[model samples]
Target: MTASALTFDEVRQARVALVGPPNSGKTTLFNTLTGGRQKTANYPGVTVERKSGRLRTPVGRSIELLDLPGSYSLRARSPDEAITRDVVLGRQEWEALPDAMVCVTDATNLGQHLRLFLELRQLGRPLILVLNMMDLAQKRGYQISIEALSRSLGIPVVTTVAMHKNGVQDLLDQIDTLLNQASVTGDGTVTTDAWVEPTPEAIRGYHQEAERLLREAVIEEGVPEQLTRKLDQVLLHPVAGPLILLGILFLMFQAVFSWAEAPMDWIDGGIASLQQWLAAHMQDGLLKSLLVDGIIAGVGGVVIFLPQILILFLFILLLEDFGYMARAAFLMDRLMSAVGLNGRAFIPLLSSFACAIPGIMAARTIAHPLDRLVTILIAPLMTCSARLPVYVLLISAFIPATTVWGGIGLQGLVMFGLYATGIIGALVVAGVLRLTVLRGGRQPLLMELPSYKWPNPANVLLGLLERARIFMRRIGTVILSVLVILWFLSTFPAPPQGATEPDIYYSFAGMIGRGLEPLLAPVGFNWQIAIALVPGLAAREVAVAALGTVYSLSGSEDAVTESLAATLAHDWTLATALALLAWYVFAPQCLATLAAVRRETNSWRWPAFMFIYLMILAYIAAFITYRVALALGGG
Candidate 1:
């Protein structure tokens, strides 16, 4: 059993890095390389940082997978690009240099993305160029001669439709081969190619080579060109594009409220019925109360939000599939360009509407740290789905469900306003932050605008399923755990026999809230609002769930959804609800996101700082809203 006697060559620890331009399918490739053998970090040094994973080859050799930030070049203008450059070049001694590198380039846009490829070629590392998006390119009549590309680049070239995993086997095979090779793949030419600059001569040479290659191997039907041009006319229209994007975003929030109503109602009804049944069949005791109010109510409250979250994602996925998202990005790039942000940042910021955790994670695509940090700082302002429950609760309870603009629901209008506030606030804040902390001119808006295609059902379904899984996991894990703790807080210190406020009022939570009220007085919040922030740290949505549990523990036996909303309406004033909403717009509530920061930074300092700073901001914002509303003599 000796290593050499086994006849099989022992596997060496191979460090592999995945790098590509934004939207070039680098993530799909990384996921394919190492699926479950990965850990995600919340907050770290740069808002955008590498995610690492592990894989063992069939030969029992180990491989470390580094998912690097997607960047257009190695010029190192931003933290993300600097990281990628440092690790790839072994400039960062703390991080292991990649043994083999995969440069993922969009097959359809190779002419443009090739600039990075050309730059990477001189790095003198074992590298392979992955021609991703091949299927889409093929459909558009692109034909790449692999051998020709390999010869041209002097490195192995593997073509793949990464999303579909097409050609993955070949890519892996080449990677394994490259890993076992003696010299680095592109290292041999480094000494001779002393030029770091892509000089005018170099640019002319590349252009000439590219023209020759296109003439020799590439084929495109005139159809795709004409089709893309026609689509771009409407999609890229100055006035029309932004309007369409806004309408779509507005309709999405509306759908989150309106379309999910039936399912949400069904979930609420089922939870209440179960609770009553449990109370009837079970012996009266702590167990019954715990099941009904603590676990069931807390967990169920978060669960009902799944439909709305998924619906929000569905619209995003469809728009992206229809190829309009890129155009929207282009349109917004006009705005982002003014502030020195990346156009590639649009999708990540959009994702923030679902959750800032993923939104911050998604910023991995931005090449600049400042751009990513600004994006991360402002992402939480996008009115994530977590706040949807709170918004829906308050709006239903307070605002009359009358239509504005003829067809929109009155509740929908309020939700839209919250979203608008987030968006408008983000823009103004981004401008301010860019001026002060991250002052820089807009980065170049160089991004591939993939051509329009029919929405692929399989991909869409897979994406939806993934979102559903993550949604359920959070409810089952983080939300569920927080619910138990909140239930305990609201239930304990069983009321003194003579006390009359409510069981919860005499409970430990009630006392804590009362003690904290003075600090929150200007914010128009009562004891209940103060106490809920405990579990809210687990997630933003849990605040509503905590409210449901705390409110239910007071002996109210109504449905979790409407009952909570109505109770708040009856108990709190308009100013209180408004202040709370404003607080959520910038609340420092997600511990998971903080934890992510800790993991990414490998230190507790950043997450701790984040919590302290955000909490302060939230309090000030909440207080301002409350005092102003009170001063206006309105509740």
Candidate 2:
């Protein structure tokens, strides 16, 4: 079978795709081959990520390499699987059929991983089989015959330790060789009709054939995954596992506060210096005020939290790459099932800790519609990184920095409590929705637990860099744009000159905030808090920025130099601060998250219901918290 006739110089760039099952190290190979040359975006309409990169062969020929989503088969059980199938068959409107397919498999578990390769072979496209994690396989005493496997499968096979970039050149050389053969044969046309979804009987036959091939070409001299199994025995323990998981989380939250303090202080000091320099250099005018009070104070307030956000992501990335995330999900299965959720929901919900937008979109993996919807509705309640700024700010202001028993910081305990509250709230909401609105039979979680390995530093660093890039980009674009508009609203209509109150008291923002204050007053929100909440609808973290700008404008120049946390600590009562913290725990403040829900569900009704319910929850939670705090003498 010849490869697709598409030449390297054809139309734009010839494309090659990496196909594999999950945990096959396909993405690691993609990262190794592409280095920093990759770009990630969604496919034309679907939310499944489209990761493509430029790779130059040893012979100096360039091709676009696509890393398709991992799938066990082309059966299209989920949106990710559907995409893999459609793209492979040239079915997507925006994607053309690839000229060649590279099927990656875990070398240590070929018996299980070869089924997907057999399915891909039926497509008759030019194919290369990659035995990734070859080093690990060899260490485990698995002896694979490269030539025998190639001959049996009728394709070239390459060994790769993708994390270490070993034998990657051989894979590239083979790709060049295949493409050259296709060009000579002049049979580059891809044929999609050769492949079809296998029936149950055909699937069984494929499995049997895969096993036979493995028997002929492979020998196992030692117990497979012995170390992984030994570790799993303890890590997957019923009682000890949950306790360990909680301990890890408690430590993570505590680290978020402890590790981030120095860097956050540096950022705060830098922002204060910049504000002071601007106040000294620029004349007293709208321009100076905009640059100093509006832009610096507002944007800096959010940027200072970057260290904490990245610290949180660092932990998540490391856990995910180390393969512990799967175990955590397994540990939570019982609790999730009791709430009418599949254990699979844990991943999307875990992702919510980064951002609810992606979390909601990730629901496409859940096969059940009701299960997916319930996951989406409760995703916002999972304290995202955006809320970290708000939570940390309030905790720093109101919660004491004193140590408690076992050497834990009280501030971190409060932070952990807030996260725990969000989790409990999500469970309660999921249960209620399941029992009422979207009630349905629950689906059991069926997922693979990948072997544990040391996380690749390159991959973890790449992830952290991408996260930082996205965060800074948001501040430059969305946050910066909103702060400008907010500055205009808070600054204009020039204060009825000679009035005793601050200039902001008579501005457009002030009037609007005042108009809403009466309704929010019961929940402990003043006009400034009301003002902040309006722009906060764009993003939860923006509320911190909004408050900084509002308070900066509402007070003397010295306010711009003082930290927002310190300023809030002085002006806001403990009850109001606690209430605001309670409010954010349930507030559906991100419009992007709503838009994601709308896109995912293909309905306005779900998003609307989501918004209304979250708002009511936020207000009620805030009201109760405020009253309780006041009664406890926090007023």
Relative to the unseen true structure, what is the Cα RMSD of model 2? Answer: 3.7
Estimate, for each residue in 1-635, the C-alpha lDDT of model 2 and write its tens digit.
22344444542466899999999988889999999998877776667778899988766677899999899998877777888899888898799888889999999888888999998888878889999988888887889889999998888999998976556989999998887776668655666866667999999998999999988898664466777888888889887889998898778777877898899888878888888788989999989988986788777767876898788778888998999988988998898999899887887897788677657866888867788889999999999877877887788888889999979999978987998999999999999999999977867578899889899888898888877886787679767887788788878888885776556668888788889999999999988899888777777877776676677533332343348778889999999999999999999898768878877877799999999999999999999999999999999
- Which is the leading candidate under lDDT? 2
> Who wins the TM-score comparison?
2
* Pairs clashing within candidate 2: 4-188, 5-188
For model 2, what is the C-alpha lDDT against the true structure?
A: 0.84
User: TM-score of every model?
Assistant: 0.77, 0.89
Model 2 Cα shift for residue 170 (angstroms): 1.6
Error of 2 at 474 (Å): 2.7
Each prediction's RMSD over C-alphas, in Å, is 5.4, 3.7
Check candidate 1 and list the clashing pairs.
41-596, 42-596, 42-597, 43-596, 43-597, 44-601, 126-185, 340-441, 340-442, 575-635
How far residue 97's Cα lies from its native spot in candidate 2, in Å, is 0.9
